[model samples]
Target: MRYGEATVTVVDPRSYMTYQPFLPEAAAGSISPRHVVVPLRRVLPKAEVLTGRVTTIDQDRKVATIAPLVGEAYELPFDYLVIAMGAVSRTFPIPGLAEQGIGMKGIEEAIGLRNHVLEQLDKADSTNDEEVRRKALTFVFVGGGFAGAETIGEVEDMARDAAKYYTNVSREDMRFILVDAADKILPEVGPKLGAYGKEHLESRGVEVYLSTSMDSCVDGHVVLKNGLEVDSSTIVWTAGVKPNPVLSRFGLPLGPRGHVDTQATLQVQGTDYIWAAGDNAQVPDVAARKAGVENAWCPPNAQHALRQARVLGDNVISGMRGFPQKEYAHANKGAVAGLGLHKGVAMIVMGKMKIKLKGRLAWYMHRSYHGFAMPTWNRKIRVFADWTLAVFLKREVVSLGAIETPREEFYEAAKPAPKVAQSAEAQLPPTRAKSEEKAKAS
Candidate 1:
């Protein structure tokens, strides 16, 4: 943008981009919800930020169809297009999963999950019915990846804290189940750390099911392939994610797994004017290639996305200025995940040495790493403050489920009162009745 060679425009369905790494903490009420997102307009004041979704793109005509949140759809023309549209949750046609399963993708879903979990606890505490209490107390999370594991871990911790306030529902009464198709969880960190994470959760009384798949979740009656069936009120689906389906509508060349195929330069294959990155692009890992591996691609993580964005931005500028484009090449920096309050796992690679950390130190590492990685000083400060407060203060156990229907009270209050009509007999005075009686007597 500083080059003044081109007018930049960023089109997205949301006005803000959520930092997904902090979602677990956000869900667990460790951080304020608003601090998790960075407003595009605030960050990029010069770039035109369109609060709408791109429905289709006709590269032949260099025009994309954008449908706003409201009203009719319109076409947007561009000289050069950057497809950083990101990815969506990958789901299958599983019976009852769509109707009953909850997702943990967006900010709204994170907040909703927090509220829903607390609401379930409230239901369990207030109810005497065995079935209702059991269902409310049972929480199932499919996918033992970072999103699934971290969420269940944090929410379970929050629920434990909340149980102290409840006379009826105790921590032992609640059942937290985590199911994964893979043999190990937290594959981002090595197998040993992953095994430890699973063990840690199990020690906390969380049921860890490995190499098992959920057959169905019809009406929240979860049936696993391993012959385990549970009627749960909350079923969180964080299984996995694929490239956004909208990418198919753009008439762009896609990979076998449905991601935009991009060269090392981050530009869409067979097209010079179009560029793609993030979870939607199958970016080549130059480090892997140099390490004598063939066709190795970068994993879909915040670390890769952050680095890719910088290189993509620089390449865009270079393209506009007719300068040589540099390929994105960065070695893996390992992975870190927080499992509730003081429990976490971190694998940091420094040169050839791999450092494995767990417990409180790993938890601090997780916070410090994310706090620095978060975009904008304003957001960074707020996130750091949340961590600081968490050290001094206990986790907030209250749930604002009413926030979803905040206007309900106002709506009820604004309703007009009922009108009552007076009958003619009631309107007559006692004197009129006596006069009528005297006339009759006369």
Candidate 2:
């Protein structure tokens, strides 16, 4: 029945779907990196999984051009289309941003961030240069959304715990600055919870800057619009995300902001068989509209994306057959964010009642909710195990930045090619060479 009866092909450069909610914890080393992603092949065995990119789609001919990892590109034909390319980090043309800023988009970035933060502590503790030490200990995070707030919080917690292992490095020796153009951070949790989050971070000695933005990060020098200048070695960019630009090439009706326009039913506005969801689709909030709210749209969060996927899939099956399509409508359950260990903010909506929580209880709720929400039982168990193990074990704070360029050390130690050696006769004088040969023969 469902998608099994019809042929399905999934094209993506990555073979797994990354559970992005756990990325902050993964970067903080609270969860294993391997457990934060679900393998696509294992999850979708019925579909033909291709580890490549769908470069273009020909809706008229019903063909898609795919560029594989290690081969020439090819065209794939399909009947019903599902556009779920997702989104990429939104960035700007800020000076030196591309060269110096670190992102928090994927698992690889999380791993790199962990290593980099720990390595900064190591460098600060060992260096005699005060300038270098100060720069090493300073961290700047831009954006105050879930990604920025949670990441800085978790990373700060990690660095604080990691400081104990070093002789000279301590919490006071480090500086963490958070910047957001918005008036409050974590706006999804409501203004009260957002204020609580800001105060919580500040009480823990983090510098919170609201209504401020970074002007430039050129040459490791951070210049803020409010006239704050500092040299920071670690600059984290988690501003926001925009829909993948590739969607523009898909020949579909798109919204003003470049998202594919779709009805509440999750089907593309004009197309009958094609469907799009997740961060790439501009889906109207039907549930909100019925509540008398106007121009409401689903936020680009995992909470809405997961629900939309289910609706889109059902709509696809209904289109394949002659059944009617159901419109997707669900109110937001709530929002929970983990700041550091034993610290967070949450707002839970049960039917018509809304409950607000903060501090240790909120942190627990954050972990519990995200742990259960992680895709697959295997990952769920592994994430819980990682947390349980942390209770009895000390935090691992070693920097293995070599993992990025794994073969660099080998290249440095490798010997050069052997030089050609001349024969003894060739080295001898012209007259003595033949004479010495004749004597040796005799």
Candidate 3:
């Protein structure tokens, strides 16, 4: 934000800002989902973005409403508010998971999970129906943290390099699976680097399971609360995240899970012209309560929301120059993930010393620390030119699932224009054309 004093604006519904750890290398096509987002009018050129969707928030009339993205619902009028709406997809009504899961947060769910895992490897390579080719090569990931173990280790390494231009879909006819109720997986990269990222995604075949849980999948069948059963026509759902429940009508003071309860100078606690930080705010982890820890907070990550967004924009410009605010603190600096091309897992931490890395030097320090934490340099030179054109191109592996039905072939070429072939007395039916005109007038 090229901080031009005051007058900011910034509503949202994606004017762009994703950069979500490069959404598993943009679902393993190796980073290109439009360089993983960041536009907001080219990084807030003096703010005022407004894509829209605030839908109500009075706070005793500081006003808010907004809705736009294409029409009515207005209002706005702020003085300082800023909650940072983030988080959703916590899911678990688990019975076909709201019509079959598949979520990765955004960037249109990582380009619809990489065109639905390469259209389930092109329906398991032109299906001959071995149970629809094992339910289109079964995928099924379900959160093991670090977004379901770096998205089933970069979609099982992009379906094992797209089963080498599939003939009948090789890579041992793909499966992947993953599921987790948390017995351990990336546990924030600790426990021996989360058991070396669960033995490097179980040495690439993937299956994992850990403490399991998934009692239903419905139509695509799966079952699992330990009883196991499968079917899987893809499934995904990186299982975690909550906060953005539109902040329950925004009146503020949220906490015990809904978030926005700030204070550690990110304001909001009793409102000081309002303010908040990432993952929808719940602040107060001031260096884990000065290390005594006990009930500490600040963990909805992104490295403590990038240092609570530079101490909530220098405490909203020092509460508009009345000054004195700056509290937010930080203490951990380690955890990289990558798991695909070259594979990964890292840890760095400084003060108490840590350093643990694994494989391809933790995948080149997870792509040079998320390509210098991508966000301008024009999306870090388009994510380092999509990792230098994925080093000599090739891995595109196709499947743009028709970009999710773009007007479905123009609604099947705007059908209904083929009804002009009805001659023969319009297919004869008016009393057989008056009994063939009285047998052609006898």
Error of 3 at 371 (Å): 23
**TM-score: which candidate is best?**
2
lDDT value for model 1: 0.91
Least lDDT summed over 10 consecutive residues: which range in candidate 2?
1-10
Please name the candidate that would achieve the greatest lDDT relative to the true structure.
Answer: 2
Model 2 agreement with the true structure over 377-411: per-residue lDDT tens digits: 99899999999999999878878899999998898
Instruction: Please provide, for model 1 over 197-274, each residue's C-alpha lDDT reduced to its tens digit, 9 standing for 90 to 100.
Output: 999999999999999999998888999989999999999999999998878878888999999999999999998888
Which model, 2 or 3, shows the larger lDDT? 2
Each model's lDDT: 0.91, 0.93, 0.84
RMSD of 2: 1.9
**Per-residue lDDT over 1-442 for candidate 3, one digit per residue giving the tens place of the 0 to 100 score:** 2455568888987788887888877887887888788788887787789898998889888989899878898898988888888788898787997788888888788788888878888877786779988887888888888888887888788878878887888888787889889898888878998988898788778888888889889898989888889998878888789899879787788988898888888888887889888888888877878889876887787878877888888888888878898898888888888778887889999888989988899989988987887766888988888789889987787878887778889888887786677798768999999999999999
Location of the lowest summed lDDT over 10 successive residues in candidate 3? 1-10
Q: Report how far residue 344 has shifted in candidate 1, in Å.
A: 0.7
